[model samples]
Target: MPTITTTDGTEIFYKDWGTGQPVVFSHGWPLNGDAWDNQLKLVADNGLRGIAHDRRGHGRSTQTYVGNHMDTYADDLAALIEKLDLRDIILVGHSTGGGEVARYLGRHGSERVAKAVLLGAVPPIMLQSDTNPEGTPLEAFDGIRNGVLADRSQFYKDLSVAFYGANREGSNISDGTREAFWLWSMQVGVAAAYDCVKQFSESDFHDDLAKIDVPVLVVHGDDDQIVPIAAAALKTAEIVKDATLKVYEGAPHGIVGSSYEQRFNADLLAFAKS
Candidate 1:
């Protein structure tokens, strides 16, 4: 249970394992660093340092009622890397964590980052507005907020379907996967999760996206029901100078845990090696 104290004194929980070039993983919203357990084992076996950290208000980290925004998320990650003096790092971020990675690079990047990967990430912008009219609508996120605020348990249960595309025809739904989703959601602070809906949904990462200079690999599912591949992956590829985009057919938002998990991990490792 190793931890790093952020600039604001928040104790952020992190897992640093194995020995080699480091690959720091930042997980999606409502899920902890444990989401990268599979990736950790695979990367470690391949002689790479697999590091994953739980953001504040998620998992073992402090459940403060504030500082759940993108700025704090990026700052916390920067502090962790600085404290560790990690360089030539490979940063892999999923969902909202992608925004965190982009912001961190924009704020604290110093030639330390070698490569980056964004998997079904939230970036450029998630919400549709004047500047980002092609993004998801605010009403959609509001519905998510309403559902979570009203009945968190059932809300997470229903979200599982879209998260893994379990609702689709021929999709298999397992009790273990459903339970894991619930457990991960429950580990997140209710207040922080509620407030973070704005951070992930409305926050714009256009500047951050434009700032990334390292080689970037964008992996997205074509059937992602949560964050559309077009608005996220395609848009991100256009902004990042040196970026490669890969799309999985019929894969859900949780492509990393779906049948394509191994493929996703393989691509990540290949990218790290190249």
Candidate 2:
């Protein structure tokens, strides 16, 4: 596996393909860089460099006992960009990965970033509170923590139903897709998976969204059961100065699935070229 050693000595595995302007992908929780395979291949074939990394404690990356928070997640992203000398980059993140992109711009600035794309991302906060009525209930995340700590294998398998809207009536999500989600999730370190539950749910990204100076494309499914469109993508687009919000009607959180792959890839290529 091609890897880069962070300052903390964690080995970050990455897949780099094609040439031309760089497009860096940050995948969702539990799943690693492999989650972005569909998008990566599309970008690479369209004359752009596609790079996705297995975040520490996930996939091929070393399992970490410390630094499982969002700050460290964003910092690791910065380290990758710096090490590769990638410039004018387009940052694409999905689910928890979206939070990473927002935090990265806020903490590290967008000196090398040309644009960003957030797909079914968690941002502008996911915790329900007095101020944010549309946010997810605290109990929901508690259930996730309990699931991971108790029985992640079965929990991940069950969670894929909502992750890709497989439970929806007239849905076309294949068993392979759901199975792949479980397989990818099982590769994650148990402790790291537990820590990430809080990272994705509690971390506020308002300041991060406000600081993004590059063009941002925010995509979310109106029917997303994981990260509600109203709380995540809608709120994020409203906060970012140059955000373009795109809501996929009747779509689920995992828009990168086979059902949505073609359309998602097309939209991504258009945005990257724009």
lDDT winner among the candidates? 2
Q: Write candidate 2's Cα lDDT for 1-274 as tens digits.
A: 7999999999999999999999999999989999888778888899999999998899999899898999999999999999999999999999999999999999999999999999999999999999999999999999999999888999999999999898889898889889999999999999899999999999999999999999999998888999999899988988999999888888898855554767788889999998
Clash number for each model: 0, 0
Q: List the lowest-lDDT window of 10 residues for candidate 1.
A: 254-263
Please provide TM-scores, in order, for all candidate models, with all chains considered together: 0.97, 0.98
List ranges where model 1 is wrong by over 4 Å. 256-258
lDDT of each: 0.89, 0.92
Q: Write the per-residue lDDT of candidate 1 for residues 1-274, one digit (tens) a residue.
A: 7999876778999998898999999999889999999998888989999999999999999887889888999999988898888989999999998989999999887478999999999998889877777789989999989988899989998898899888889888687887898899988889888988999888888898888889999999999999998788999999999999999888998844455897898898899899
TM-score of 1: 0.97
- Best TM-score among the predictions, by candidate number: 2
Kindly report which residue pairs in candidate 1 clash with one another: none
Whole-model lDDT, model 1: 0.89
